[model samples]
Target chain A: MQDIYEDILRLAAGKIRQRIRAGDYASHTAGLGKGKLQANIAVMPERYALDFMRFCQRNPKPCPLVGVSDSGNPNMFTLGQDVDIRTDVPSYFLYEHGTFSREIHDITTLWQSDFVAFALGCSFTFEHALMRAGFSLWHIENDKTVPMFRSNIETVAAGPFSGPMVVSMRAINKSRIQEVIAISRKFPLAHGAPVHWGDPSEIGIKNIDTPDWGDASPVTDDQVPVFWACGVTPQVAIEQARLPICITHKPGYMLITDVDDDAEIPVIAHSNS
Target chain B: MQDIYEDILRLAAGKIRQRIRAGDYASHTAGLGKGKLQANIAVMPERYALDFMRFCQRNPKPCPLVGVSDSGNPNMFTLGQDVDIRTDVPSYFLYEHGTFSREIHDITTLWQSDFVAFALGCSFTFEHALMRAGFSLWHIENDKTVPMFRSNIETVAAGPFSGPMVVSMRAINKSRIQEVIAISRKFPLAHGAPVHWGDPSEIGIKNIDTPDWGDASPVTDDQVPVFWACGVTPQVAIEQARLPICITHKPGYMLITDVDDDAEIPVIAHSNS
Candidate 1:
């Protein structure tokens, strides 16, 4: 059963990678590549790579690093054998001195010898875990991006990288919050458990209906707003850092890696049994 | 009941701080300030602060940073309001270019304007939790330092900071492994969960009775060796970095903070309840 599941995931990843490499599927990869781990890509010059890596380390909940490529290396060997950082993602956003410059399908021409690539765990992994556990995400069902907000929580700063933590909100049924947390906590790479639940104001979300990014999902009276550290957090910090040049996966468009969503957490050996 | 418990903890902290500040007690702080979180102290010049901070961020299991002080600041407000980094720790180990110079009771005179202090969550917190959960530790019972070894696991390297991960070993009864993991996972700041178990050879341990640091305890046939990310990891990295000057709390002489070992894990609000 597990092998069959993995075979299907490999097939999905192969098809998606081919489409992304051919510049065919350039839209958000929200529901694509089922059961495969999707990553948020950040590429920067080697000079800033160390600081950025530190930034990801300092703010892990917001930027859980899954894999890092050597400086000037486009291959993320740990993430996948054939994973190429330059053209694996569906779309890329270019930043100049932290300012949004333009979007592109490939960075083969723009790739530099000093460039370093980082693959950070995205919320999509945990969202898949939550869905598999039988909890429904309203945003996915409604065909909208998960609502994200700039929370008052401050990320631990590293070098020029520092900013408020950004969080993605989901309206979960009150009864299933524990199950949602249990399943999501297993995937620490994907933001882990929700940072804040119940009252959004506790984490500095002034208005739940109006989010700073993504489509806002309305919360029913039977549900509470639960927030997880968002991958957009690193992007916000990158903009604040204002590096000479930065390349990131455009919002919603992510790098689908060969890692299984369920593989991050290792099985504990049952000594008692 | 809760208020009374906190009051007792505050009182314990005050007494420990007074003794540590007055130079009346200058030794390992183990078994002192019960229920209060103890931290491994790392102090270095501001020039190397960013990289060190990143180092802690990248290698969290070995270096879980709980609080960081501004450069040249002696006060760690986040760790404790009255906590003075210079005098709070029982003993300080001065390192010059990665070489241990000597141990001192206070670093007040050596303190510089470029100095920065970092408080890393120590294993004492989780050990206390485990003890409270009815688990017995062989090292604690025998009044010896926990056995620590250099592992094959290489920590994610940052600028001037990189080394093999060091881990502490504890033998646990076969029946208590799950309970031990469950309790430790709640304290992510204190190395979280075991990195490996069963065989020492799996993580590069050549001899079970010999350790790179600390006293080794034999694992009985009924017990399995459980390894956790050790605080010594950063110390090894610092030695490798060879900064001009670095100050750290001597082994077992930790900085006891006002934060509760159990307080870091916030209780998730059960909406159903």
Candidate 2:
């Protein structure tokens, strides 16, 4: 299983990033890296950074900001050593006037001097933790993308960023729903816990058989569909704002960072250590 | 005990803020309010708000942002209903050109047209949780202020905000230290768990009895001196920035908010409920 590749995965983060950088790898980064922090990327001009940050702060579940690049700086130094926002992520989706443009492999030519890159926590980190604990996930098992839906939960707006919260759903066996919730709770940066369970209509999803994004996997009689705040929620808001220009990671293709998602902030100073 | 005043305290949030606003309560807000979130206040011109926010984002443990006002707006709408930043805080400390200017009861007259208010989570919330769980904090038991010291732990800087982190010391019993850690870890907003334990020298504190701020509560032989990131850290950074004008809460006087300290984001939407 995945454990057999554990050592490979550990050694893969930087190498895979290099491969992606060289145009050797340009697909979904679902299982890439050292099984550490992989982020959902959003790049925008400096002028909108503050309001966007406020929106993320207010609606943390949908947009848990894990790291941010300083204005006009492409390197996310705080996130990881030598992690460049311009080329690290495998794919990028361009947005102009809040509308999706063509997806591209690299954006070195379009880089703006004042652009700020924001890295929000992705569910992949928690999913990794959950699988490590011996739980099976539907998407990983079937080799399909996880189904995501636009929910009715209204996000608290800040300036021009506002929209319905997007959620990713997983159908878990009824017997393991509680354990799943408990496991996910430990990773707050990774969406924390399910916003709702038991009913899809509870959050205004008209049909569980269909998802707005990704392939659908209907809940069996013995499983409960659990939902988590999706990183795509921010993309939805950012898209709606119709900013003159913005760039986001093509969903499922993320920036792999050197920092471990499981690592909490250092309690002891490195100087003291 | 605080329990004796629980009922009265349950109804005291708005009334206390009203008194503080009307110039009736000019004392510390350590034990006031409905026992929810209490925040450290920082007010500065809008030009500095983005950078200050970056500072908070980069250094979350010591500067965990709980709420922020709209640019130039005094009302902290997201934190609490009718919580005005201008006069709700009991005491205000002014800083001009990186120097302490004066301490005043209110800043109603000094409120700037483009000022932004930031509310960082205070340690009081977690302290409240620990005390409610039957743990005795040395400072609470002795009616002295918690001893705080500037430590060797340097904060990740953003723009002009940079300094050594300030830590509050509590002499927790060696036996209960683990329990204290568990309890405090639940309050990430409230500085979370101890940054250091055992020896103060490990964090470059040569004198435990001589705190840089507040009263001294030296560790006993059977107890361990536990240190947590202090909210005063941001104040220190803001002061060192040499801003022409800025306002902060006096050492122990905090802004009480209606949001519960332990309240996680709603697992289900209110509209769904």
Candidate 3:
């Protein structure tokens, strides 16, 4: 199992996709395929494509849209070869008119020609880069989901897609704040740098212990909470718009891609050797 | 004489209209307002509005559209009070079917009900900031127009707005590269930072001294020629489209606005700051 874990970390897209397709492995894919890009998935009716695309354009921080697919074909050729959206992710959320309806492992039966899929860059890639660069992460150390909150910040309205931006919070020591910002900026497709830091109420988070989604984590006395725009913002926008139907990956389940993570240009010129 | 600069800048928006209405102020608007925003102007027929808008969206570095007025109406309420597009700009270049027809100081005679005016952010504001930040500008020091070149890099095209990008080059000492980037990024509406640095040939500039437009400056061995996307790119596209009639500011000539130069937020820090 240890040998398999090491090999999976370096596996190519085809092998990983095959494992995911066959249901041979079903755990969290956070560190799997170490350097490939991963994204949050939002599937919706084609009728809302224009409005949703505009929403992504207007609020690039929270919903940094990477690849938008043509109405209903599952193959995202731009993201990777033979990438099937219907069965790519480990899990999904089915929403109906702004409410949580249910969760499904596969949406192959629900696939439609009128559906559109938007792949948004996730923070996991940047988080990985930061850790490799020696920046410590509290949520990762404690094995908890990063704290998330609804902020007072308003997203630019696009047709019916309008709502407050949701952000993920991580506590970073003062000494490493610049290091974290430098590493994360490279992945603009990922949420990028912290939109807000220090005080939580400034962005409308009432309490640090309670989060709208995900497991809560504690903040140490010496650390300040750094907030990054989250991928979940688009999902929140879909819910707020009360679209008749929409589907998204369950909070932590993401669509892993073939794009090499190392392919990204680090915004920082790493300190000389 | 210096005391008159402010009064001249504060003329009743209506009175300014009268002089522009009468074909006065035919020179470039460089130092007219002293501390007000001056914008690059683009006038196009309504038929090409949406595509041109999308082109601006795709290529924001060169075309940071500040204000886009409604089709046919020359009055731009957002830009200034009683600001008439036909007469506000100091000079206009009329391009007919991809050819230069004539240069005119005012365009009331050529005004069409379907014409739309787009106000783009110019590099002048950022240049001012750079000077205040203590960076020396070679072209401005020499009292010459900044060097501009047609690069091999192609802009993302939309509809008829397809052409190679034009860039303005500045020679900066190697030690100040980061400082220049940090200062310029604050003004995104202005062309922002260099698209390419260090190697001019990498972006397809064949001769360092021979520019496609404007006078070239000498670059010392300790300096690198940094390039920023120029507003002239859209003009090239408009000329290529060969519409029956198109009007633009004659190179250096620009429209001075009543907006304060320092009024904008340098950095948007949420309450957390």
- Quote the chain B TM-score of every prediction: 0.92, 0.92, 0.90
Q: What CA root-mean-square deviation does each model show from the true structure? A: 6.6, 3.6, 7.2
lDDT by residue (B1-273, candidate 1, tens digit) is 444334434458767787779976676667678777888989999778766765665566898877677667687765665778889888999999999999999999999998888888889989988988888999999989899999998886766888899999999999889988888887777989888888999989999899999998989999999999999999999999999999999989899877777652311121010
Better of 1 and 2 by TM-score: 2
Best by lDDT: 2
lDDT of 3 by residue, A1-273 (tens): 567556666877667766766665555677776677888899889777656765675566788666656567776655676778888787889999999999987889999998878888888888988888977777888878888888888776665787888999888888888878877876666877778888899989999889998878877888888999988788888999998888898777777777666543211111010
Q: Tell me the tens digit of each residue's lDDT in model 2 across B26-102.
A: 77777777567888999999888888987887778899888877787888877776888999998999999989999
lDDT (C-alpha, whole model) for all candidates: 0.80, 0.83, 0.76
TM-score, cand. 3 vs. native: 0.67
Candidate 3 regions with alpha-carbon error over 4 angstroms: A1-6, A12-29, A32-37, A41-54, A65-119, A129-135, A174-195, A244-250, A255-273, B1-135, B156-162, B173-202, B207-210, B219-224, B234-273
Per-candidate TM equals: 0.80, 0.92, 0.67
Output the better candidate (1/3) by TM-score.
1
Q: Which stretches of candidate 2 lie over 4 Å from their true place?
A: A1-12, A266-273, B1-10, B265-273
Worst 10 residues of 1 chain B by lDDT: B264-273
Residue B172: error of model 2 in Å?
1.8
Docking outcome class, model 2: acceptable
Instruction: Give the better candidate number (1 or 3) by DockQ.
Output: 1
